[model samples]
Target chain A: MNLKRTTLIPLDDDSLAESIFKSFIEKEMMLLMVIIGDTDTIREAIPKADNLAQLSYFKMERWVLWVRNYEILSETLKKHLKASDADKSKEDYNNIKCLCFSPILDKVDGIILKNAELSYASLQQSFFKAQAHDALAVNI
Target chain B: MYYLKRISTLVLVCFTIGIQAQIISVIENDKDQKRTISLTDKQIVDINSSLEIQLSKLQLLDAIQQQFPQLKQHLELESKLIKLQQALRNQSAVISILEKQLATASEQATFFEIMNGFLTDIQNDPLLNERYNDLMAKFFSTDTFAPGTVPEPYIFSNLNNDMLQIEQELASLEADIYAVSVLAFKKDSSGGDRVHIQNYDTYTNRDYVTIKRWVTSLSTEQKQQLEALNDIAKQNNLKKTNVFNELKIKLLEEFKSITCIKDFKNNSIEFINNIQLNDVVPTEVKNKIEQLNLLITRFETLFLLLKTDMDQWQITLLLDIKSEVETIVTLLKTIDTNFSDVTTLINQTRVKTKFMPLVSEFNTCYATINKDFETLKQGAALLFNLQNNYIANKAIGTEVLAFTLDNLPDKGYINLKGTGQRKNGDELLIELVLRLPSAVENAPEQVVTIEQREFIMQLTGPRSEVAIGLIFANPINKEDLNLQNDRNFFYTPSAALLLKFGSNKSHFYNDFLDFGIGLNFATPDFNTDGTPEFGTGIITTAFKNIISAGVNYNLTLDSFYWFFGVNLPFNLPGIPINNIKN
Candidate 1:
């Protein structure tokens, strides 16, 4: 089956990301995500963002973090793979990777994650891609 | 004024004519005993019932007369009792007055005779014997009887035969003392002991027993005095007896006079009530009488007509008058054997030649009186029937007849019931019922094999609707064993018009119509293998098809809370539901 992703805008003073996550839970889907620290917040110098609580089925520690600039995307990926021990020489790394990130449109991006699995490198890469798309759309 | 006077004269003439027309001859023999012959059904019924009632009354009277002498005597005494009572009163007064006088005079005479005897005794013995001398001395000394003195105020004292004899006591004294003295004492004293020497003892001892032993001689004057007093008393009693006899005779004569007049009046009323005097006779008889009377005034004309006519019709018309008079006389004789009909025959003889005038006179005599008699008879019959014979108000007479149809089995029975009369009307009902075990539920429709279905049918015909109504009264006591049975009832019920048909026994069934509904239940019978072939449940469906809209009920007796109404079925067959569980 072909996979597709849909984004929801944050409501005024409301957790639009959490609402989307809850819709996934009602459909009994396996994975959910929320993007934080995007270009809109960096350019405006805003800090102290709220985080959604992780349910028992999904842990907050598995969430991906990303920087905003496209130039840092390669650098962010290189550090993430090292910290995740992707260079452990001959070990199989495909199943160990729990997530991946892809930029499809200016403020839109894709985050792929394995159901009920986690990895350090996949989280860092997905985070950096999400931030780049947010910065690119904010700059325009 | 002239017209008014003329009118008055005319009125006076008319008033005289009216009086002349109403001049009813007080014929002693006339009586009306006419019977009404009615052709109407209602009148026929009334007359029949009236005849029955009168016959019963006559029977009662006859029975009383036969068995009770008091009743016969009462009838005989009833006529003369008033006069007899008056006579009895008069006679009783005379007898009582005469008796009072007789009683008083006789008592007086007795006292006088007694006084006379006493006076005689005094005169006969001037010197007096010892006893007489003692008594006379005592009598003269006592204040009550002293000589030449008034005796006891009410006491009688008389002098007799020129002797100063007290008539009242002198006779008694002589008889009492002298008889005893002579019997007891001899002429010479023979006894050795002298029992009495004092005059007082001789005078005081006057009793027969005492004197017989104490005295020896008696005086003849005393005996004569006693005899005369007894004769005087007897003569007084004889006179009183004559007076009583005379009073009794006088009373009887007076009673006879009043009773004769009363009897004449009663007999006169009874006679007038019996004969239909003014009743209209046949026109033919009237014409004949008229012709006979006319013949005398028209003798010359009749003689001229005699040459012209020798007609049998005219001769027969004249003969019919004689026959009609004979018939009337015969009828009168049949009613009262003692009636001579002499006045009728004499009147007919005087008018024998004046036929037309006699017919008019006789018709005039009987017609109005006949009308009056008819009115009285009708009124009396109505009054008596309504007053005494109208017993249907509260009196209920019931008669029940039960008959079983022979065509059915022994278990099957039919009863024909009839009630005598209740209140005022008659009611009739009939019921046909069939009771079978619940096993019949599984049986085929044609499985009515037992002879006549062993059913029981009942019919009740009563005289009134207020009486017991048509009802299916269940008598079964077992709750588990439901004994509801199939019932088919039909008969004409009580109603004004229907009750008339009930009186005619043959037409009773023809006029009556009825319909009924019921339920049936029972224990299911077992098959050969002990399996119950029939199942039980409510069997409420019912349908009745009659000429009218008969009724259908689920549970007719259950307060009619749930029922099925059958409305106007036209020639429909019985609708049965065997499988209630279905």
Candidate 2:
């Protein structure tokens, strides 16, 4: 049995900063962005993530995100995915779409994603869609 | 053409009766060509962890003498914290009661004594004596009860008695079948490999060898230039610390993937094809990039320091230089990453026509920049290793180990020997130990003796590599391998090597059915009287959920007892419930 492929994710709820960098060294998880629940928290998180993205060791090909762990929150995930199929007039309709685009990454990036998968094309599309607007708020 | 590998390994056999030569080399030499080696994620993590540990070792709070202890303490406490948390959860409610009892006793002693007593009580708990037994299954064990849990069994049993006895735990014992979950030990990257030699377990720390003993070509002029580079790096321009990345990010904004598909294809072909190998593109920002090519020339001179034993001042001076070079290289990589992504976008089968010429143009420029980046990384790592003082004679060392991620193997073992301890009692030489599964975690650090011991080496990985360890048999720790317990029901010999029949595609966890017979020095037997019917106790292992149901017979008793690999949990007052260690 080849163990190099075996991935172990020890659930952590401690310091998100240490957890992110420590797990970055682990490389078992591929985190593109860190989705945050609180907008006020982005000030601290974005720089930490920026430091990670810029770290010489990480050598990130693309930028990481500071989104929500909507995928793990299954009910929130279903609401967002189903909202995309419904009317587009809802207050948070677009934010829900971006959050649902790849929600599993919220818990552990690169988990056996069943809801949706992340790739360069998909990420670029979602990124530009948000980049055109206020950058933080997903356009409804 | 996907990934060009230039693999070169230099082997200096550390221990043996005779000196042997072993080397692996690969090269399709094109000067200044890009060489990329793909590594598995696990391998990358291991290397990163190893480097992190190496860095931590250099950051001592007090002095060099105290550094080892602090680093060792930090690592041990972190790993032990996981198990300590589990034990704490197991004894949550009782902790406050125990604390109050200790608090009442503290009225007689000093605060320090009370604290010591409190710690002693927790350590002495028999149930929490996790180190002594297979409480490991509980330590890092999954908390999920989805497997083999016989739920809602509180009803229907022994209804005829004055008080009906519903023993659900015992009811499962009637079945001869056993179910056991498979678990593999995680790799401990803190430091040292704890290997068992004989009756006692001896651990050895990381060993270092010097690189390149040949005469160095570092001229007086080259040293002066490198010093200038180092000085530039040492300047703490707080505002401009991130100038290189900032400039690169701004430059990338201009080169962002052209949105219009027509412009993307046409502009890429035109812009890429227009790029000359030796010419620089027009830039509007000052990012310390103008002298990027010249910097590579300075870093390449580090390769000449093969024979030069650097003084502490020079080593410290060069670290800053290393930092500057890496900063420049990283900026270059950002460019490469963008270039590669744009090229990857167009290299699809649908656009094969523009692909070849576009790639042909891109590779020409990419090769030059890629080679310089690779060289800078190699130079930086070599300088870092020198700072760590892991040096040896260059005559025997053919290749310097690269600290960079690009060139490392997906899986391999590095043998670091513990050079004998220090003469001064106050000194702490780093102790390297290749830990086995059953190696005592809390064993007190002791002065390791120097001796070349014979070993029966076994290599096991979930993949083709079997193991990187020696074979030994101690009844106390029967089989101390990740999958060793899976082959639990066996005669553990004084020395035994695992035998496998090509099941290459299977994961390390998923067990396939197989049977083998091994000779045992001490055989086991179980008696109905709650004593081992034989001298030694029998152990059973559930392989791939295939219940190993066997009967052991003691010739003296002339009685048969059914044994299952999964020991059943029972409530008999005097008998050992799950374990029957002889």
Candidate 3:
């Protein structure tokens, strides 16, 4: 399925980055992919994400990021997320379980999550399911 | 002796008869003559008694003549004695006849002497001489008297009546002369001989010493008689002069009185005219002028009988006075005209002085009010323009949305476009499109339709430009947004620095619409229970660079809940900040 959504955010750089980071965390993904311009803050955040997954960085005009399994990120990494590119294509995502966070995502096939659809129960359900699957796989 | 007595008695009888007959003829022939002799009763008896004595004596002589007729022989010696007695008788008769002639001659001489004295007295006085000649001409012109003939005693019979008439006229004439002399011949109080007659009428209790002297000099009577005569002549000359001086003083008074009246009348006329021509004449002065005029009019009539007697000086004076009166009348008329003109001019000046300042003040007030009215008119017109732009722009937003919805496309991408121009040089090109989902139940399988709307607004003329602004979340409500009670609400307070490119229109600092920004703060209290809302959003207007309206949008639980309402830049009520600009 192809899905698209748009959101208006505050003009402040910190608030913009927070909005992008929050969307990324809600998706519960592992393998992280990033597209960023040549900036020092993004270069530093790339090494920190190695504990969750192998980091791939591409130099571009706008910021774009992808995560595979549920992993919590540090606040410093979230503050730099506003540089993410929002208008990306479907061919950019390699796996079916990938979660993308951007200002705008066009011609991408996925389930759209907005403020209306993200309730407290849905977030808790996603967190527990991810935890249960991880414990089961590790024991086996 | 008896014969002698008888002859003498006869002779006396014949002589008496002859005398009686002559006397009777004289009395009978001149019956028309006015006799001066009026006999009394006692004189008639005395003459009759004397005639009786003569008749008795003649009877005695007759008896003696008869007894002596036989005694002729002794008559020689006796004739001598008788002759002596006859002589004595004849002498007695002659003596009686002479006595009668002597009485007649004595009466004639006494009458002539009295008349001659009266004429001499009149001729000797200057005042009387002039009038005596006039009177002689008047009286003798009617009587047939020879030149130098003494008037007969018969003419004197009417002397008292003539003198009475003359005295009355003289009295009138003297009174008139006294009045004139009172004005013209004033006696100096200082006892100087040089007389000053100016303003003589004002002198009181004056003694006319010069007139008295002139009167006394005209007569040679005793001092007492002269004084009495002067006093009588001055006091009641009209009554007493004819009796005392036998019409001599009366004629003198008449002549002088007539001459003086003529002279004083001319002087009075001149005096009155002078008074009338004075620049300022009091009531008393005017009264005096009228009195003098009356005196002249009366005296002119009174002196008419003396017209032939008027001297050259009197005629000249009258002519001069008439001319002077005419000149005074003309001068009075000129003065009256000038007075009327002066009164009118003063009134006009008074009115102008009283009202001029008030008129000037009124004009000034009118000018000030007119200027204020013009300013008010311009302000009203500016406000009207702002109001019209606001209504038109708001209507365009709502009507365009409704029109686009009415022609919605069916489940496909459809585009609508419109273009218009605003009065304040703003141009608009609106493009709208509808995108509908293929199926709502497909759940994440189909892409959600996106609605696209674009408005291209630009300035189309000079003094026209668009203002750019920024919108932001309000700091007061930034932390209050939560899902429990503020699920679909947000608020922002914004500030914008407006830039107008290619236009010279200035901006107001407090006007949010000019900057295209406003403050919008709202909370859950503003919305209905269970109803989701987008809260209030206030936008500054760019129409003529003024702050205009605000919009509140609300999205309900099941649909979009919103409405359009007007807003002010400040938290004040009513038609926003446009009123302040005006």
Q: Provide the TM-score of chain A alone for each candidate, in the order shown.
A: 0.25, 0.26, 0.23
Per-model TM values vs. the true structure: 0.11, 0.17, 0.10
Which candidate do you rate higher for DockQ, 1 or 2? 2
Interface RMSD of each: 91.5, 25.3, 98.9
Model 2 spans > 4 angstroms off: A1-140, B1-505, B508-532, B535-540, B544-548, B567-582
How large a fraction of the reference contact set does each model reproduce?
0.00, 0.00, 0.00
Which has the greatest TM-score? Answer: 2
lDDT (10s digit) by residue, model 3, range B231-258: 8646763443224233223322333323
Give the docking tier of candidate 3.
Answer: incorrect
Root-mean-square deviation of each candidate, in angstroms?
61.5, 37.4, 83.8
Instruction: Report model 2's TM-score to 2 decimal places.
Output: 0.17
lDDT by residue (A29-132, candidate 3, tens digit) is 23123322223433332232221221111111111252212222323333332333222222222212222332122112111132112211122122222222
lDDT of 1: 0.26
TM-score of candidate 3 to 2 decimals: 0.10
Off by over 4 Å in 3: A1-140, B1-47, B50-260, B277-279, B303-582
Of the pair 1 and 2, which is ahead by TM-score?
A: 2
The 10-residue segment of model 3 chain B with minimum total lDDT is: B45-54
lDDT of 2 by residue, B400-430 (tens): 2221111122222222112211110111121
List per-model TM-scores for chain B. Answer: 0.13, 0.19, 0.12
